[model samples]
Target: MEKRYVLEWLDRAINEFNPTQTQSANFEDHRFKSFLKEVMDETARQIAYLKKLAFQYPKKRKFQEVLDLYFSALNNLIDNARLNLKLIASESVISKKALELVLASLADIHTFLLNRYTVSINPDEPLRKYNLAVPVIDFAQPTDNILLSNHPALASLIEDEFDAVFSTGNLANITPRQAKHWKDLNDQICTPEQQNPGDEYFCSLELLLIERNFNSTKFVKYLTNRFTSHMEEYASGNSIEKLAYIQKLFNQIPVIKGLAYDLQHDDLSLTINNWFICEIEFRSRSNTGKGREAPSTATKSNGCIKKTADKVLCKLTVDQLALFFKAADQSKIIAAKSLSAIFQAVAPYLSTPYKEDISHGSLRSKSYSVEGRDEEQLLSFLTKLTRQIEEL
Candidate 1:
């Protein structure tokens, strides 16, 4: 059987059999095997039904041709499912290998991923419309809690997916060129601009690179150089595309977390023209609580302000700013109205001074940013919030 049919069946299974948290409570090795068998049985019935339908319409000219292709495709899927089932059954217990096979099966069948792999369905016009599938009313799809449920076990699988910090099988290799190439990529991903999917992918790669302290610096340098050239070429014509890329990147690589330290460095002053980027970076950091628990205070942060020729800027890393705001932003005792008043009181001086948006992509939150432009406003906001809460 071509890979696509199995992939299609698997994709259907994933969408059809969404086992909820409650249903997943009783999943075991036996239950997993039962699922594979169930799909195989269901598939066999669909093929038989198609065969019966085909025979009844023997007078139809294209009937045998359609049945022949449908039977072959459906049977191929059943055979593959049987092979998977056989592999599952060979082990009396669900060993690591069995679990891995199951995971691979799930990954293989994911619908979005199916589009990327080579699909060899009956490309002919007649057969293209004839889907040899029965309505699957009662199939069981396993959930995460059922298979490889524990944290440690799952972590091991994730660890296997990584070869090194930035080196994964998912991406191809590149050669290093110059420092400028690396710097541009660093800026695009690290800066506070709205990143597209491609940029987000680069950001994810950068995060992994940072996590391992760039142990594979030589290889990373090569990728940086190649990526920088690509960015230069695409930045102008494909700016809008960058937005859609991030959504796709997240879908392709869904394990990113705690972007709590992308900022908070001395790599500023060069990009002050684009201060809004810094503002975006600051809010993002604060939201993740990266700076809130730090030993820094608003009064102290304000003290770091250096008198400049025209602008009143705080001499603080992006991280320090995030922390100051996060610390001030936390006040559990304040009334909602009072808090809004306090926030409006200190809306300037902060790099990214807007209140946190009341909602996020596809979800809503009751929080907003009340951060200040610098230490002074942050302190002022904090004082007003605290004072208002005390009076209340």
Candidate 2:
């Protein structure tokens, strides 16, 4: 008898002799006994047939393919026998036997047929020795247009804008203003047009300022708002948690005085000028009771603004600005260095005063002092300046 048929017959005998089915009367019947004997005989015949087939295919076919075919045939026969047993036997006995058979087959395959084939190997090529140094360009040195062309943000913006125009079939309608707006947005710089109403001239001016590396505190405020808007566009669920974490870090920065948030998208941007310039102070004087009332005085102060235009202008050049931009676009280290250099050069002349009693942790010290009348005048000046920048 073949090994497969012997195993099937043994399985049937084990199931019949098992005493666990004490509740079933069918196990004691003569008809069930006759059926079990027939199953054992059939299993013996299948095992003999498999043994004959295996010995006949000793060298005529690949061992792996022959094994697969033999196993497939045996599996079909075993499955059919199991189904027949399930139909005739009690539900509990059939279920237990089926599980045992499945487990036994898995174990047999794992032990006898695992890793029957070997995988071919390929050799790897030797590593080549080549110089990988990139040419270092100093921010202090003049940079050519070729360097600017490598700026990631600028390059990406140019490509995207070009593709947008090409795809929309509106290449002819593309103007310098639109190009400028795109450039400013790519650089995280804001134009006056973006803050107020969109206009071609202001957009162009924003581009010029970015190209020139001009430090506009007012402009930064507007740019922060723009960044907030952009971040909101991509934010969704769980973004609010992220925004809260960012705000915690942002609050630690001394220069960042206030933050405006877009909750719908969890977008946040710092308003540096909002803390320094737009801060308001209020004072009141009153007499308690009517007898021997003494005169009371109230005072208000503001922040300062100073600009050193000549100092800033003297330090700036097209090449330096281009290099600054290129570096700014590539890495935060480069951007911070360039920005610090520009700010240091312009700091002496660019100190502006706040027109209110704004505190910067110094007691009894005022950067800009203003009376009631002067307060109105300063507010008007600031409003005009804001409008002018917006219209640029």
Candidate 3:
């Protein structure tokens, strides 16, 4: 006979949570078991409801986040139950009350998960009412010959609009150094012949549309590429959470948003792709926007925007970051001995207001549940790790 694992027993208990119909010697024990079964029934009902919705709309991006959160919360509860099972099995005199702890813990997590899901996810009615149909832009077919003839004027208008967008400080909180880097890179993209490159035109067109602040064109790139089943895709190569933020940014006249949307839905051209990947290298050593009170307030606001951009640009999710930490722990990537130690070494850079608030359970959950600070923290931590790894 194969030896049963502790986790298997725990799973069985959770799956068949119904208590025996026979009355227990103690009335308290019978009542507690009855109550526990009701809680388990409700938990099962919620899970089934969510699972059905998830299955019905498997491709719904918004719903996917909620599903991930539910999964994370459920997994965390199960992990604790597994530990409880091991303890119960080890005892010479097993306490039935201790076994109840496994199911009891699920109640709190389930309640929390339900509350979060209810708050974050809106009803499908609102989303369905707002139709975002993609417009057809056939580059080969010109709708108007006269408009085509005035390409130079149109180009200049686009340039001026984008200039206004930059001036408004509404784009991703880019510093002087970053602005200069892009300017210099644009020059490099301009060929010796000075005839506009295909990618350069497309990139400009995207920026112009963003400057115009049209929602229809916001995800035009994604819709186009996805519709065409375009082989040239970048979103698959990056973190979906990060890419989601990038798309949100784009919807707000944000450069990071454009980059994120392009990276996700369409093929970002070689020039722009290089710019996106290498942008971290162009950091200015000193703070340029310092000293003045006005500049300081602007800097703080811009700082928030930059943090959002960084989160959008991040390639790794918290789960992926966790895996990296696990790998590093296994290989002794850092001199730190344990996973907790490795987390501690990097916590100052990644952890929130309180480093003590950083827990493995929470980090694991944030991977699925949407959290901006966690996304930003993971991105910063991963970027530092990647740079250091390159040196080694």
Candidate 3, 262-347: lDDT as tens digits: 22122222222223223211211112223233433211221232221222233343444565576567777666656666654443
lDDT by residue (tens digit), candidate 1, 132-171: 2212122111232222122333224333323331243312
Q: List the residue pairs that clash in candidate 3.
A: 250-257
Off by over 4 Å in 3: 1-140, 143-288, 291-323, 330-338, 349-392
TM-score of each candidate structure, all chains considered together: 0.21, 0.17, 0.21
lDDT, residue 203, model 1: 45
Residue 145 displacement (Å), model 3: 15
Model 2, range 246-358, lDDT digits (tens) per residue? Answer: 33333332221111111122112213323222221100001112322656323222333432222222222122233333444456644444443433333333212211121
Please report how far candidate 1 places residue 131 from its true position, in Å.
65
What are the clash counts of all predictions, listed in order? 15, 23, 1
Residue 65 in model 1: lDDT: 53
What Cα-based lDDT does every candidate model obtain? 0.36, 0.35, 0.40
Evaluated at residue 167, the lDDT of candidate 2 is 46
